[model samples]
Target: MLLHIDSSADTTADSVTRQLTEAFARTWHTAHGNSADHRHRDLSAAPVPPITPAYTTLGRRVEREGFVPPAKVPALTESAAEQREWGLTLPYITELLAADTLLLGVPMYNFAVPATLKAWIDRVTFPGALTDPDTGESLLRHTRVIAVMARGGGYGPGTPREHFDFQTPYLKAYFGSLGVPPENLHLVAAELTRVDVLPQLAGLEELAADSLARARATLTALAAA
Candidate 1:
């Protein structure tokens, strides 16, 4: 299954990250002769709840104390709140595990991933949830993952604000914990988005379009791969 997750609150017709991810996902379906099993999650429309103490505490017990039947949870005691939170999160976890590939649409807001995306991540990721606590094995390690990102400004290695960019590196670490290596985790990103609309950088409109095109092409190739 192909899990396509979009976290951009920008519902504008010109939302680059959303366009990129959707195009990539569609290309994947086309590549598979329209038989691809694609699933979608829109984080912006329905945001995920942040981690709570009940969930965290109970989840830790599950991780440390170990499980009974379900590998996702342990055979430990829990409060009603924790169980309720678990009830909310288990379907997402199950869907993620069932997917063979994941396509994530991430827009850099304030130099980091959007809060909606983070909330989803917090809900799905906890110690031992995507890993084996007893053996220290990564359960989701083999899944193919790709991140489609859009940035308003340049934050590349030589850019003046290079160090200000946290989205790429942080996501690499976040998904890396779940079995996606730095190599397996690919990012097809478009930069200078603000330049596309701002009069100050109107001269760079062509450059922005070029960046978007390159990102789309990269996504297509990766989806095919």
Candidate 2:
């Protein structure tokens, strides 16, 4: 399935990342037709488990044995124990492994990605789950990813504030560490700035459009292949 994971926390109806993601998905579906299965997850609306101590412990066990440990015996008036018991559900490792493509909608927050998106990455990046334990090879066999990003300021290469843009570099390193090739990591960025900088902003938009067109073409070829 083509899993579309939107991590933008913007509740506003006119979210740029959401709009771009929807457009990308629509184009992808139109090209692939019934050959592709669609699945969507909104991390902002339904927050997944953050990486807590209990979460880490449960995740480790699941990674080793592919099963969560059984619940312990309950004690009298142990409401806290009930909460621990609920945490024993098996992690969604299998669903992640089964995905063919992952379309991520990531927005820059304080020069980085949202914590919710990082949490999702933590869940999927198990030691032996998505990587080789002995050789340190990535188990993310699927090679396609489309990351749609947006920022409030212009930060492309050669721009004065480009050094401040850590979103692309961080995401590239993170996903590259997981075996996604540099060529497979496509980004579409939109810059929001002051009205006085509209001309420069238009240039950025043109660059983004050109990149998007190239990405769509590459994806079409990949789908055909």
Candidate 3:
């Protein structure tokens, strides 16, 4: 199963990451045909609310007491608010757990991931939910993540602004902690995405176009693979 997620605030033609992800999805679907199941989640559309105190409390309980089955949530939940939060969060966890391939369209927002996506991350990353508590093994070890990232400025190695790119590294670290090996995580990033609209970046339009083309090609190839 493939879980395609888009976090770009702009769900329009202007979003380079969205274009890349769309290309990826199309290629993937064409390659897999009816044999594959594809599920899409637009984080910006049906936004995942940020973690609440009640949610954290429930998460803490899970951490302290270990995993609990959904059928027993009523017995485990201490309050209505926690129950509601669990109701909201459980689907995200289940969706992720069922996915063999996670396709993420992530646009760099102020050099980091959008708060909407982070909220989803926070909700689903229960202590024992995505991992094996007793053995410290990650349940997502076999899953593959293809992150198509877009940045407004250049952040490649040796670039002056490279140090400012906090998006990809954070994703790598977060997924790594969740038990996804480096090889299972594929990153296809397009930089200088603002060149077409930003006056100062107009001179780098060629570079931006090249980057975007490369990113699109990579996404298609990865999807086909």
Candidate 4:
């Protein structure tokens, strides 16, 4: 089963990562047909709320009223943000656990992953609630994640501004700690996204197109696998 998630806030044509994920979803359907089950989440439209301070301040009970049957003990009267935060986090983890693979469409925002995507990660992986305090074993460890990313500039190894990019490495650590293996966490990234829109990057248009083509080809292989 595949959980297809799109976090792009830009319009369809303007969002390169969304376009890449569309290719992935289309290729998967063509390859597997009805044999594979699919679920989708558009994070931009229904954004996941940010993790509240109470997420860590409180005891290991964020998933209580969020996932399990038991209700909030004292009923979070401290703050409305705290109460609402718990209500949304567990569902993210629940959806994440329902799939064998995750196809995420994310755009680089200020050199990092989109805020909407970061919010989802922070909430779903709350300490104590979603992870074992000691062993850190999580159901998410069994799932594979394929990230379709779009960046405005190049940040490959040894690039001039390579150190400026934090999205890829942050994702590796974020999902890695959750049990998504480094090998299983795949990235299909198209850099130089501003090439077609900004005059300063006009020369990189061909490179951007090549990256998109490569992303599609990689998705095809992943679908077949």
| Winner by lDDT | 3
Evaluation by TM-score, superior candidate among 1 and 4: 1
Q: How accurate is candidate 4 locally (lDDT)?
A: 0.76
In the range 68-150, model 3's lDDT, one tens digit per residue, is 54545557789999999988888998999999999998999988999888988998886578875567678899999999999
RMSD of each: 2.0, 5.5, 1.6, 3.8
- Residue 67 CA error for candidate 2 (Å)? 14
For residues 1-225, could you state the per-residue lDDT of candidate 2 as single tens digits?
777888888857566678777777777788778667888889899776755565555445545554222222121113553345233322445556667778888888999999989877775564355654556565564557778877766686798898998888898888887788777777667666222356656546656556546545544454444
Summarize candidate 4's per-residue lDDT along 1-225 as a digit string, tens digits: 899989999856768888778778888888879667988889998888676667655435543434332143236425665556666665776677678889999898998988888878777665444454456466667788999888888888888989988888888888787677788899878888788778877777888788778877887798767
lDDT of 1 by residue, 1-225 (tens): 999999999877788888888888878888886876999899988888888888888777876755322454634546788778778888788888888888899999999999999998888875566765567677677888898989988787887889988998898888876777677788778998999467766787787888888998899898777
Tell me the RMSD of model 1 versus the true structure.
2.0
Candidate 4 matches the true fold with a TM-score of 0.83
Model 2 clash pairs?
Answer: none
- True-structure lDDT of candidate 3: 0.88
TM-score leader: 3
Full-model lDDT for every candidate:
0.82, 0.66, 0.88, 0.76
Worst 10 residues of 3 by lDDT: 66-75
What TM-score goes with each of the models? 0.92, 0.72, 0.94, 0.83
Ranking by TM-score: 3, 1, 4, 2
- In model 4, what are the clashing residue pairs, if there are any? 141-179
